[model samples]
Target: MKNIYLLFGICLAAFLLNMALIKLAVDLPEFFTSHLNDLLCMPIVLSICLFIIRSFSRNKGIKISLFSACSLAALYSIYFELYLPDNSTRYTSDVIDVILYFSGAITFWLVQGMEAGRKSSAIKKAA
Candidate 1:
């Protein structure tokens, strides 16, 4: 779907920007590469995961459920906050990351709802 492709583009762009901010440039604010970096990709990753799960699922309605969004966010937060931190020294465990993950998940849910509403209106107009 177009939206999925767009999400991929956004994800790729964000990742590149994060990398550039952290590695290529020296004078840029650390917030962009450090604190905000964890926040930046959360929504994109969650959205992509939701889209993929929805596409593969037998129940199409599962895509719009808040549970799916929250579950994915929780899983992501646990992995990055707990498992990854324990396994690697590059990333440290932070409670704010979990909060950001929830924030991103909520944003994704709202966006998806709006997108669905738009599609519905378009279909009604076409009919």
Candidate 2:
């Protein structure tokens, strides 16, 4: 369906952005904590996911992109956790980062769900 293509594009963009931001986190030697630094892509990815879901999904929930988003978040998080030079600088990948990734995905779902609900309600009122 048309929605699937949009979801795929969003996922691809999120993956690319996440990868780039991971590199940024690696090279940036700053005062910020690792958690804060690693969280840079949270909003971007979530926004992309949420936008695609809201525009594409007509259902009440984020069923269409749920598995894709969650799996991508998990696998991407694990990849970065293992490959990134976090340990050298004490930016170790704890369970919390994984949680953050999942949280980001869930947050995207919830926000889009709310948007969908509002749109449906508006349509009903207008009708």
Candidate 3:
């Protein structure tokens, strides 16, 4: 839980910094301007989803499942990268963004695993 919160905080902070840079008209590298949001999308989104799920469910220990996380990333990638670009002039398809979405998903999964590991370790210690 603490690991997820930390991950969420870091991602959220980076995201806010990116937004602040954009709003302030600060010139930044293309990666920061373009890909940072893509890289951050899933972890932040999934963390919020996990928070909601935990809030509503009887099981507070619930985390986003790997399959669900990857599936969402794939769906979001396709929607933003494939579908939107063809449908709207405002959106351009970027393959790199698709890769970043999956990377974010994997990051969330790894951090969530860390929290699980920590819980197990605590349980073992308590025993």
Candidate 4:
């Protein structure tokens, strides 16, 4: 639960920072404005999903497995990139957005694994 909270807090801070940058008319690169933040969306949403699942289950803060995380990420990417873009006037259809979403998901997966490894090593050291 502590790790989950830390991960969620970090993601939320990042998401909020990005949104603030956009809202404040900060002079960011066009890519940052258009695509880079999209790259952060997966970790943000994935962490939230993990937090919700762990909060309800009595599993002592077990993170979602890589397969489950990837599946959910893909589902979200599809919804945002394909369905939403096609259906919503606000969201323009862009192939790059899909790629960015996957990149973010992959990054989150790697980070999650790394965090687990660190914790395992630390526990071993303590023992």
Which model scores highest in lDDT? 3
The candidates, ranked best first by TM-score, are: 3, 4, 1, 2
TM accuracy, model 1: 0.73
| Whole-model alpha-carbon lDDT for candidate 3 | 0.95
Residue lDDT tens for model 1, 1-127: 3554565477668878778767866576766666665665656776667667888998654555678777877998899899999999998988987887787677667767766777789899999
- Specify the highest-TM-score model's number: 3
Ranked by lDDT, top first:
3, 4, 1, 2
Q: Give the clash count for each candidate.
A: 0, 0, 0, 0
- For each candidate in turn, the TM-score is 0.73, 0.53, 0.96, 0.78
What lDDT tens digits, residue by residue, belong to model 4 across residues 38-76?
Answer: 777777788777767777899854766778766776787
**Candidate 3 off by > 4 Å:** none
In model 3, the clashing pairs are none
- The residue ranges of model 4 lying beyond 4 angstroms of the native Cα positions read 1-7
Model 1 is weakest, by summed lDDT over 10 consecutive residues, at 1-10
Model 3 per-residue lDDT tens digits across residues 1-127: 9888999999999999999999999999999999999999999999999999999999999888899999999999989999999999999999999999999999999999989999899999999
User: What are the lDDT figures for the candidates, one per model?
Assistant: 0.72, 0.58, 0.95, 0.75
lDDT per residue for candidate 2 within 70-97, as digits (tens), equals 7877776877776564556644667667
Return the lDDT, model 4, position 94: 74
